[model samples]
Target chain A: MELILSIAIGTLTASGVWLLLRPRTFQVIIGLSLLSYAVNLFIFGMGRLRMDAAPILEGAGSDPANYADPVPQALVLTAIVIGFAMTALFLVVLLAARGLTGTDHVDGRER
Target chain B: MGALFDHLIAVPILLPLLAGALMVIVDDRRRPFKIAVNLVSTLTLLIVAITLLMIAGGMTASGDPARTSVYLLGNWPAPFAITLVLDRLSALMLVLTSVLAVAALIFSLARWHRAGPHFHTLFQFLLVGINGAFLTGDLFNLFVFFEVMLAASYGLVLHGSGTARVRAGLHYIAINLSASLLFLIGVALIYGVTGTLNMADLAARVGDASAENRVILEAGAAILGIAFLVKSGMWPLGFWLPTAYTAAAAPVAAIFAIMSKVGVYVVLRLSLLVFGPEAGDSAGFGAHWILVGGMVTIGFGMIGVLASQGLSRIAGYSVLVSSGTLLAVIGYGTAPVISGALYYLVSSTLTISAFFLLIELVERARDAGADVLAVTMEAFGEDEAEDAEEEVGVTIPFTLAVLGASFAGIALLLAGLPPLSGFLAKFAMIHGMFNPTGLGDGLPIGAGTWVLVALLIVSGLAALIAMTRSGISIFWASIERTVPSVRVIEVLPVLGLLGLCLAMTLQGGAVIRYMDETAASLSEPAGYIESVLTAERVARAPSGTPDPAQGADEETEVAP
Candidate 1:
């Protein structure tokens, strides 16, 4: 399970980086989103793999070791929201630029 | 009211938020009301800042400052709840935020209002974030503060709504938004690993981590570091700095000057507190790699200075160099070095800001267009004498003198010239390197120390040469043109800025001591951690529960 998650994260990161390097404005935005997701997952995984039960003990038994660290999950939750806000703001700006300049290249000029 | 006063910690942020809300309802055409709010809000900020500074001074003297002051919102205690802490570092930064804010507010009354109605509101809101970022004890709060500042900055950057201003501001926001995304990810990773969001708790916690956990922590740190490096304009990550700074309106640029140091302060604060050997025992952790990054930034900034032709851009480049120098010093990660970095930060901030404000005077006087000097001269020589009816105003005579002083501040004071505060601060740092009476590791005693000494000299000389080139191009060459009539509104702010720079240089002694204390507190993280965790720490295992979670939050607490 750990190995599969690791490959999945790595693949996401690589593709995201490739997109980040592209000249197209839309591609770069997509790349940034992808990269942010990969990073979020990677950080969450750093709490060490957990198979037992959820951290809270409302119904089932709960132990510190048994629960996947909920703290990182909380942090990731905030990151996802902030990331979405930034991406949306940038997307609007990007669209505006496209409308104004008639180009969607990140560098602002047509190749 | 008493409960609110008890939480003196939150006032810096709360005050600005209230002021900004109030200003929007103010009539746009009533210049006096707008100016009045700016003054009162800024003055309140200064008062709170001074009170905070006094509190920090008391803590530093007490030595065992954990007993100092810990306030959580809604009476929530730390660890289980969000915390707000004011130890030596944040308190010191809070003071500076207020000082710079007040200075810029006063200056902007005549400077930025030309842009439009909401200018003062945007300014107050921006301060709300700056002060909040310094005071916040949690990662999420820092991100929130960052947005508040960035959003306001976007409006300020394009405040005049010029085609060029909007274009450059867009690029600036785009880059910053990406950095904000990375910041969020870094925070998430750290939270995932450690349950606590409080910095003091993180400091004590991250150090005790297993190897796998350490990897996670370091990864989080690196991502955050990259984000700040971009903000602070660190070497390769800072290509956006010159164009963005040079592009902004002058008074706007002056306020923005303090913005980059916020990044440098955070990066240094985190490395020394979270990654230091005291916390992690990682020999390579808080090493001199940051210093090398600073050097590259300095070099890049100097190259930009020498290569750039116009005053606006040249001033921008000088600021970049100043950022580089401060980063390099902070990279040293020693108490003495950090103290020196603090002095350099203030001195450079003042000088560069004064110079940028002066640039506007030059721009108006020669009727030089705002973009590039070359473009300005071309347009001026070819255009009708339409602007001939307008005077360049009060700033013309002293523009050269102030510009010279700014370059000198970087060269003399920043490079440690004697009789100047910069020199004294630098002396304290180098002396600490070999201070037999102090806390430094023994310097190379003879040859190695000498080499370090020689390098200092070379770097100083290089900075001087760079400044000399800048001085010649910006003022000396530009002086060959005819002068237009000057105005009073513009000249007063320029003079005021100059006066402040001079005072800092002249009386930099007391300032340096305060700066040193700020540095000392960060170099030894024990005080910061002890203060934040005292309420709950007595319950841990007698043999010792041994936690590194404290280190994570402590490292993140670094204000930028």
Candidate 2:
């Protein structure tokens, strides 16, 4: 399971980076979104691949090691939300740039 | 009062946040009320900053190295909830931010506040993020505050609607967004290995990690440092800075000066706190790279300065030079150089900010068509009768005289000329570099140190040439110039900032003493670790259980 997850993350990140190097702003935005997803998954996997384990403890006395680590889950959740907001912001700015420059190239012109 | 003092560390982050939220709801048409709110909150921030500085100073003066004020949010214990720790370093950054924010806020009052819908709200939010970044003692919270700072900055950078600003803002946002993703990855890697994200706890754990874990930790730190280096405007990664900063409106650019230093501040804080001498095998992981990168950044910035045609771009590159000097000096990791770097940091930030603000006022009256043509001509090394007719004026206008004098002050300060704090700061660094005490030696300086010293002096000279060329072009070269109708509001902020720089020059002794103490405290992380880790340790002692959830909502009372 760990190996499969690692490979998946690697693939996502590699493709995202490749797309990020594209010239078009739309491709760059998609690339950033892909990269963010990979990062979110990576953060989620930091808790060491829990199987059927609870993130929340029912009682005050439950051992922490018995449950899935909640911190990474929280962190990944925050990352996902922030990533969404950032994507929205980037899309708006890209549209504005496209409107003003009459091109969608990241550098504002097609070479 | 005692309770207020106990909670004072949280106020810097909270005050701006609350005021910003309030400003969002206040009708934009209520301009006076919005202005009143911004003024009151910023002034209050200044007061709180002065108080925090005094508290930090008193703590340092009491000779107790472990006397840091750690505030736990949501009534949680250390390593469990978010903690805000105020040591000498953080307190100093808070004061610096407040001071710069006050100046920028006043300068913006001239016309910039009316530019957009949520200008005041965004400014306050920017402060919230900056203060929070400085004070947060946890890595994830640092990232959160970093996002806050970046988000607010994106808004401010695009505050005024212009084609140049939007284009540059897109690049700025893209670069920073990628950097933020790297920051997340780095944090995740570190958290995966150590099972902790509290900075103090991480510092403790990093020393005891297994070899494999240590390797991962170092990789994470390197990646994290890249994120900061991008923000710090280190040579290659900071190509977007000149364009973005030059294109932004004046007040935003001035406040953005401190924005780059936020990266420097993080690098200094984390490098020392988490990976300092006490980190065993990882004592000085990236010091050499920082030195090399900083030197190259200085070289790049110098070239950029000399090649820059516009005064705004020159000021932008000067920011890069300032970052390079601080980073390079910091890379040395010596107490004396660090102290001097701290002094240089304060003086240069103030001067560069004043210079950015002054550029607009000085260049406002020049004919844009002729100015651009002249710049293009100068760019091609043509120095003939392009504007020779207008250069025959004898009497300088009053506003022109004030501007010329201010320009001269800025040039002297940026170039590190004699009789100013800039010169003093650079001299102290060189002196400390050559004569670092306790090195047991014939000569303590190395080849790398010599290279840094040479770069420092050469960069100063480069700044001198660039400033002289640009100053002549703007003030002296032009003939058909209308005397810029400067307002008192705008002129006062520049004078106030310059006066502060002069004051730093006059009181170099006391300021250097403070910086020396701050640097000394920074060099030893044991005190920071002990203070933070021990804060909530005692509160959980009576329970005698290592239960992570015990103090989830308990306000662990700090001992006075």
Candidate 3:
């Protein structure tokens, strides 16, 4: 499970970085979204790969090691929401840039 | 009253937040009402900040021995929940942020506020984020506040939308978004390694990390440092800063003078608290990088200042130079140098903010092409026709005189000339570096100290040259300039900021004492950690006595 998750993160990050370096504004926006997804997954994986382990405590004095760590899950949720908002904001700004500068390049001019 | 004071630790974050939300419900068309709300809220914040500063500095009658206060969210114990820790350093930053906000808010009242929709809301929210960033004790909470700050900054940067602003805002958003991602990864990695997200807890645990975990922990810290350095406008990562700051509206840019410092503030706080001398294998983990990065940033900023064409860009690059000096001094990592760095931080932030506000007003008097025309005329000799009507000993207009004088004051401040707080700050910093172990210790200074001293002097000289060249063009050389009709509202903020700088200079002894205490507290994080970790939960109503099983259920319920 860790191997698959790590591979997924690495692939997402690599593609994101590639797209991030592209000149087009759309590419950059997509790259940011992909990178955010990779980050969210990485955060989720930070709690360690656990299958079938309940995230909540069973009762008082229950051993916490039996439960999957819920903190990273919470963190990933917050990251996803923030990432969504950022992506939306970035899209609006990209459209504005395109309309105003009459170009889709990140620099706002045709190179 | 004492109980109320206990909650005041949260007000800097909450007041602006509630005010921002309240402003959202008010119709944006009612500019007067919004302005009144903003002014009242910001003024209240200033009072609150001063009170917090007093409390943190132990000036209050009810002073605690630790001189630190922690406000746990939901009245929970410290490590289990998010906390807002208020100490001398955070209190000082709060006061500085509020001061700059008041000035920027007042300046925006003149004309810039009308350029965009929901300007007041964005401005207030920006405060919420900055104040929250200063107060948050949780790493994830810091990330959240950072996003809040960046979100509002994006809107504010694009507030007075122009082609240049949009372009610059695009890059700013893209870079910051990437940095935010880095921040997240770093936080996650640190959490995975340390098993705690709370800063105090992390600090306690960081020292005890297994050898294998220590490497990962250091990597996480290093990554986090990169994120902060980018925000702080350290050289390579901060290439987007000058352009974005230059393109931002004057008031927005003024407030942003503190924004870069936010990065510096976090780096300083975390480096000292989490990775200080106590952090076993990780003690001083990234200090050398910060020192070298800062000096390089200083060199880059000097070049940018000298090479920039516009006053605003010069102001932007000056921000970098200031940040570089602070970072370098922080990297030096002695309590005394840190004290002087704190002083330098406050002085340079105010000066650069005043310079940014002053730049807009100064540029208002000259044509957009005045710089180009001035340069061409300098390159090719002045036209005979233009020289024919050159007036001898002409009297400067009242407005021009005031603007020029303010410009000169800012120039002196930025260039670290004598008789201003800037010079005093640098002098204190150099003195601290020389006498790291107090007077007469005669400790041999390292080669790095010499490099830093040289960089500080050279950066100041660069600022002097840049300001003089631009000042000559704007104030003296322009032939067809009309005196801009400046309003009292706009000018008051600039003067108020400058006056504060003057006050800092005049009251240097007291202020330096405060900064010295703040630095001493920062260097030894024991009190901070104790206050944060052992902060007591507020007592609940007697009727709320709960069973342990029920309490456990409630905890699980709230966990997600």
Candidate 4:
């Protein structure tokens, strides 16, 4: 389980870094999104792969039933929402830049 | 009673939140509405002061023979839901932040019209983030608050129209946005492993991690540290700060004071709660690199301060250097070191912001028409450049005096001079690092001690030279224009800020004592985790939405 997760993480990270290093603003934004996805999944995996166990605790069934940890999931859900807002904000800024200044070099201006 | 107290915990966050909404509604440029904003800001400052006083007073009887106070939010308890967590350290930061906010707002009223778009509104929103960041006990909320401030700040940093401001502002936004993303990633990893976002709770859960898990935790920790280091202007990570800060308007730069502390606050919280001695004892590790990073930061900042020609930029470099000193001390893994770091943070934040405002005043004076003040007198009454509140077109004479005084105080404090709290704080840190019983075992205590001492001396010498250069450039070196003056609304805030900085200096003993108790509280990770996690953990499990604990466990999966 860890091995597959690692490979996925590695692939995502490499691709994201490449995009981030690109010269276009759109590519940078895409890179950031991909990177965030990798980070999110990697973080999720850290809870240690427990499949088929609902996190819900049974009251009378048993004292020590197997269950998934849900804290990271809840937190990551919040993060995903926030990340969307930010990426959208950046995207809008990117569009605004294209409209106002006529260039979308990753640097955003004549540096 | 408890509910009432919890609601009281909401005041700092609530004040700015309501004010931001109100400013957007008020929407007009009338003085009355502005006054209303100022009044609310003043009241907010008072509320912050009250909170700090309450915490300080409570600390006198706390676990330390000194003092302590921690406020959990929403009756949600300490480690579970988002806690206000107002121990002495946070309370102190809160007081400084509010005071600076009020002062800056006061300075902005007449200046607001000059500021272009929705100036007061963005200012209020920025405060919302700062107050939230200082008072929050949850890491996720911290990120949320950070973005809020950064977003508002983007508008404000570019408030007045100019190509330079626009360019500077974009770089600023990009860097902070990147930092914010890193902040989330780090938090996500921590939650996965520890299965909790509650800071106090994370501390408790992380202590017993397996070696492999610890490695994953450390990776998350280091990444998070990198994000904050950028904020604090750490060597490589902070390359963008001096330019961004130096380019902003005086009042705008004044608020940037709170920005650096956000990173320091995270480090302090992580050190005290998540990475305390217990974490070290259990995992056979200590935060050694924090010290090394801090030392390098100070060295780099000093060199930058010397190299920079402009007054505001030099002040900006000083902010970076002081942040480095604080980071290094925190890394020392000694209680006293943390306390010293806290004092340095407070003093440096105040000093650098003062320099920013005064530098603007100086630059404005240079740009002024013939009608302003007498050239030589306004140019550099070295002494009056800071203290006086009366200016022809000049910022207040009293303010100028206070600014000058605070600038001097930075040198005194940053250099760890006698009769200032900075010296006492450094003394405590050094004592702990060198003393056997304090650091006590295979930790490279002797080497760390000498390195820290060297940092102190080098930073001190650099400050001495940097300050003198700033003093001359900001006030003297005739810049071929009439004098700069202050608007009626601006005086009290800058003057008020200088006065508060002085008060802290005067009350140095009390300040350190408060930090001592808070540091002790922070050192005890057991209580923080025990406070937030288990109770919430148990209650949430029954709901079946899957407890966030799984996410916390993910933090562990990344461990090795």
Best by DockQ: 3
Model 4, CA-based lDDT: 0.68
DockQ class, candidate 2: medium
Clashes of each: 32, 1, 0, 68
- Candidate 1 C-alpha lDDT tens digits along B27-63: 7767678788778888988888887777766643445
Q: Can you list each candidate's DockQ?
A: 0.34, 0.61, 0.73, 0.24
lDDT (tens digit, per residue) of candidate 3 on A3-108 = 8898999999999999999999989998998899899999998899898998877646889888999999989999999999989999999999999799999999
Preferred candidate (DockQ higher): 1 or 3: 3
The per-residue C-alpha lDDT of model 2 at residue B166 equals 85
Clashing pairs in 3: none
**Candidate 1: how many backbone clashes?**
32
In model 4, what is the error at residue B130, expressed in angstroms? 2.4
Q: Compute the lDDT for candidate 3.
A: 0.89
- List model 3 lDDT by residue over B156-222, tens digit each: 9987676788999999999999999999999999999988999999988888999999999999989
Candidate 4, position A28, lDDT = 80
CA shift of B333, model 2, Å? 0.7
User: After aligning candidate 2 to the native by TM-score, how far in Å is the CA of B227 from where it should be?
Assistant: 0.6
TM-score per model (chain B): 0.82, 0.90, 0.93, 0.82
In model 3 chain B, which range of ten residues has the least summed lDDT?
Answer: B387-396
Best-performing candidate as measured by lDDT: 3
Give lDDT: candidate 2, residue B26.
91
DockQ, computed on Cα atoms, for candidate 4: 0.24
